[model samples]
Target: MFASVFVVILGLLYCRKGSSQSFLGRPRLYGPSEALAKEVVYFKCEVPDYAGDEEIYLQLFKVGDRNRSLGGYTSLRGEVGAIPKVIKPSHEGYLECVVSAQNNSGITPTVSHPHYLKVIDPVKGAEIIHSDPMEFYEGNALQLQCQLSAGTHVSYKWLLNGQPVSQSPVHYAADNLLRIDRTSSKDSGSYMCMATNTFNKTTVFSSNSSEVVVTIKDFVSSPNIAFTVLKEDSQNYSAVVTCESTRGTPPITFSLYNRTELVTNMTTDDRQATFKVPLVLDRHLGWLQCQANNGERIAYSDWLPLEVVPAGGPVTMHYDFDLGENYAIVGLRFYCKVKKGSHLRYQWFLNKTLLQDRGSFYYVANEAPKQSILLLSVGRSSTGTYHCEVSDSFDNTTAISSKKHYLDKDVLNRLPILLVAVVFGCFTALILLVSICCCIGVMFRRRQYGEKSLLNLEMDTMRAAYEGDLDLSVYNEDPDVVNAARGDEFDHASEASVDE
Candidate 1:
């Protein structure tokens, strides 16, 4: 029984080896069945229970061209199953692979199902296809298309003025076509189309179409004017007036009007025109309007009223001081008067030198129309001529005081000397007049006393001769002696009076 069991075990082992060999006769390829051009493909034919050590071969060929082998491998064995085959297909078509196995007994081969490969080339060119009408009008429907000559799976994108044409309520983009429900002047620009291969989005292979200029024609509308005031004063005003149309074509001319007459005419190749109105007067203050013309249509702006008033006169300046005073002393006040001006500016000058407001010696006392006074704490250096200048802020018209007043060394210094000189002169004249009156009185008195004195002297001499000793008696006795004595007395009296 033991011998019988051994023989049975050997028979079962042979049956198992035969079953494995039968399955190896047909090998199945295991790899990617579909590939692209220039794509590396790896494949291996697998056989169940076959050792890796074997003589095997692999062959690759296109379908329906079995005679022309694209590639192949040699010296493959069943122990090695089927050698892995690597291939890179150059063209797009169906491809097939065959694996052959060889051993000491024989050789067997098996073919795999065909593999489909796809190759792609980028888009080479693109163009914007024109519609029926080359020109568009405002509020009109329009459509544009992009035409491309490219490989499979190509896509299109539209651009306007180098920006993407996005879908909106009025614009629609479907596939390679763009539609506009309503067009306007804003839609007038260069339109372009771009074609790209979607198969390789990362490769960035795209073609741009030639720019197509779309002209949009429309009537001028929404006429309006804008004003920028450059300068404003009481007399005149300067401004920049601009006329514009919200929607219009180029070559538009603008005309500015004051009341009914045209003031200026301007031509522009744009939608708007600007004019600089310089030194506009009160007469130019009426209703102003502007119009725009584009050789086909004319649009007018609403009337804008402009008003200007007259400016004030130049500044007039004057100096006020005490006329009776000879010199300005310490604690003296003077005034600068500014008149006939608006927005006046004041400056004080001392002997042609600018005087600062802040100083210890001088300061502004009362700044009023009547005053504008300058007070001084007199110093030796304060003795100089002073004047003031006034200017109008608006017109820059300046005026300086005609009278320049001055301070001098103290008034007291020369006043006493002058008073003394005047008093001395008057006293001298009074003395001379009194002396003339005295001389006249003396002459008259001398004449009157001369006669009276003669009589009085004779009486006195006779009295003396009687009262005295012999001399009196002798004078009373003799008339001649008495007359002589009287004469002598008269002479003495007259001489004495003359001397007095």
Candidate 2:
């Protein structure tokens, strides 16, 4: 009996000791619900019977990853802390903190609820979006939208001229869009959109700024057009017409018209346009005008008249020479007539030598299509066969006088002595008087030559009335000399017959 009681007492004592060792509560881990990368996080393990000298350890595990811990198991005290500096976006998964407390009696381990850590990156490529009609008038409504290429959750603020925009009843912001009820000239300035979010807590991302310009315009008015003659000639003509509206909205259309037919059309956003007519003919001659339209109003310019003359026509030439009947001693003149031709060239020749108007002895007195006069001061050197040669520069045709006329100084010298002697004898006087009378006779002869020279000038004036069928040559030799010689033979025969 004594031995059985001693064994019972020992078994009871062993049971009590084992129950005291197992009396510690389960270990509990305490930490923040969320953490950021590279931030220090502290975790604590609690035991109902924890001792200051107990061995405690901490470990972090990523949720859904059973193969490894975020940070390898770390030996620590009851309270432990860690800094995950090299954490990446892949480390943004759920995180769990496990803590174990151990003493000489037993070990107690506990795990914390899954915690989420956010790894953020900055927002990039911010932008703005809007519609056309970039230019607006006062009292118009406007809307603008701002967006970002990155970041899901973002807050937007409007800025004007790099300053926070003041909110008014007419101007306000809606999420990422800015709206204006009635814009005014004060609203004309640069606008920017700034975006901020949790991902970029310390930094703000901004979109490229946009500009708004407002104006007040007047009613459309008549457009002014200026006409410029670029090139013009008998065959072809060219001109440019420019039109502008100074007081109207842009996108103006201009139309150029010749008479009633449209020649060309152009449209421009700058409220001005130019029309060019490069090559126009005689048929295109008429009144021209331009019209401008600005969608709301139409205006017309003053009429501009264009005239073109036709070129090229038939060519004809008529000419004659004047040698007085008595004696062309003073001077001689030649006349040429051209009709039904344009761009005609006249050439005069004396004995087949080209006569130039530069010299004083032979010069062109008057040059015209109806009549051209070549006056030659009479002298021994002036005696030459003269003829006119004409050319039609338009058709490149040439014509010469048909009949050749002759002038001989010898003929006048042979017949002039008898008349002079008879006139001088009728005025008989003393020897000295006779000498004076001879001098007077010489003066009279010179006056006669002067009168004969005027006769040739008169003939030149009358040449225009000469019939075209009459062949008259104003050339090198006189045909009348042969006729006069033949007449002398006839005169001799007639005198002999009378004597017989």
Candidate 3:
């Protein structure tokens, strides 16, 4: 009979182990699977279908020390199965529970499966660490580390510009570190790190570090210089020199040098800087140079020589015209320049009268310090003599004027006198020719009709006075020739009358 009872008990135990559902008197433990270090956690062990008067005890122990209870609860009627525990680093292991009851079953104990209890230290004072002088050059490596003052089982993630850093081949994140193998100008902005740890599968604690500013700069190329010369007087000059780089970052330092001696230096957020230099005659200015730097490298521009030229020389003037399809002048321009001068002033004149700069009719175009151009739209009003006067800025006493240029040879003032003189000369010559012809006619008449009588001349003179077509007053200087012609006419008339 005892053997049969023992076999029955063993069969009952085997059946309970094989079933998917827990037996009626078995205990089930429920609580948080993980807790922070030094935190309080509660564990509840419930036994289904227990009587009120039964005495129950809930025992907690580590999985490896199941024979000894670390802490327990004792109560009658199985009503005090709720247990409290303080989690510590020493308690970081699998935990288990056993519930024993004294009732009709007489001190039967049910053991639960192991529950993993992860003990973690809460995160505090999270921060991001990087090298000093948070400036980097393009194509260089950058490293960042996320750290916490006290934490366990922590995870790290990187953020840029308040957003998650996108995954790329150049970006790496592992352990507590983030690395960028290749950096570019686009990588410049605010950077931060996030530290997190899982309390349980459903709960997480996180802390964010303060943002850090990172700047990426590009290497500067070779520098270049541009300069302009302005003459202040005959012996003094000034120049404006500009230094620039085509491709580089800002906050660049530009240095100007005269040979090996530094003239001046300037710092600006732009890529270009300007400087002023003075030049004096009879004094050496030295070779000019420009240099650029941005904390990474230095670059230099080509050297330039500084020389001062005096503002005096011979002044000359010339003209150019544009013609239309019909060969008519449409536009005219007069250019006046000095052969060699530095700071010369120019003035234009028309017909010895100073010309004012007026639009379209007359104006000055491209009026440089040493050269000037007078532009005119071809018209009757613009037709006149024009000239230019050039002088230095030292004093108004010394000056030079160009030769005269005339649009018309006979100006308005000389036209009438030339016309009257030509007319009077022609009139006098015509009267002389008439007098000479008369003299020859009279000599010819005297030689042919020398025997003619004075009585025939008196009769013809009376008849010619009656004929109005012949005016005998014109030959008053030679009275004999007039009388000879009249006598011939009278003889002809007398012979005709006789023949009739």
Give stretches of model 1 more than 4 Å off.
1-124, 132-142, 183-189, 198-206, 215-249, 257-264, 270-286, 295-297, 305-308, 311-500
Off by over 4 Å in 3: 1-26, 32-39, 47-57, 61-70, 74-80, 87-95, 99-110, 114-123, 131-142, 150-221, 245-253, 257-287, 294-296, 303-500
Worst 10 residues of 1 by lDDT: 308-317
Tens-digit per-residue lDDT, 1-500, candidate 1: 99999999999987865653454444455555444334455545444445656666667667788898766666444432333333443445676666655543334456676666555556776888866576755788878888876544567788889998888999999878989888887777899988876443455567899999887778776568766544475555576778888877767788999889998988877788888776464445667798888766688899976643333333333433333345533455666655443234466778998777757678765453233556666668678987776644334444545367766756523567778899999999999999999999999999998999899999999988877764444345577877899899989999999999
lDDT of every predicted structure (CA atoms)? 0.67, 0.62, 0.78
Better of 1 and 3 by TM-score: 3
Q: Report how far off residue 210 is in candidate 3 (Å).
A: 5.3
Identify the candidate with maximal lDDT.
3
Residue 439's lDDT in candidate 2: 99
On a 0 to 1 TM-score scale, where does candidate 3 land against the true structure? 0.44
Query: After best superposition, candidate 2 residue 451: deviation in angstroms?
Result: 99
What does candidate 3's lDDT look like per residue over 1-500, in tens digits? 99999999999977855441233366677778678888888887776656556467778888878776767887676564778887777787788888765443444577777778778877778888887468878889888888898778888888999988886899888877888889888788999989888776567778889998999998776788866665676656677888989977888999999999999999999999999898664355778899999889999999976654445667788888887655666778889987665545678888887876665488886556757999887777788888888775444555788888877422422447768889888988999999999999999899767656776788899898787877777656677877899999999999999999
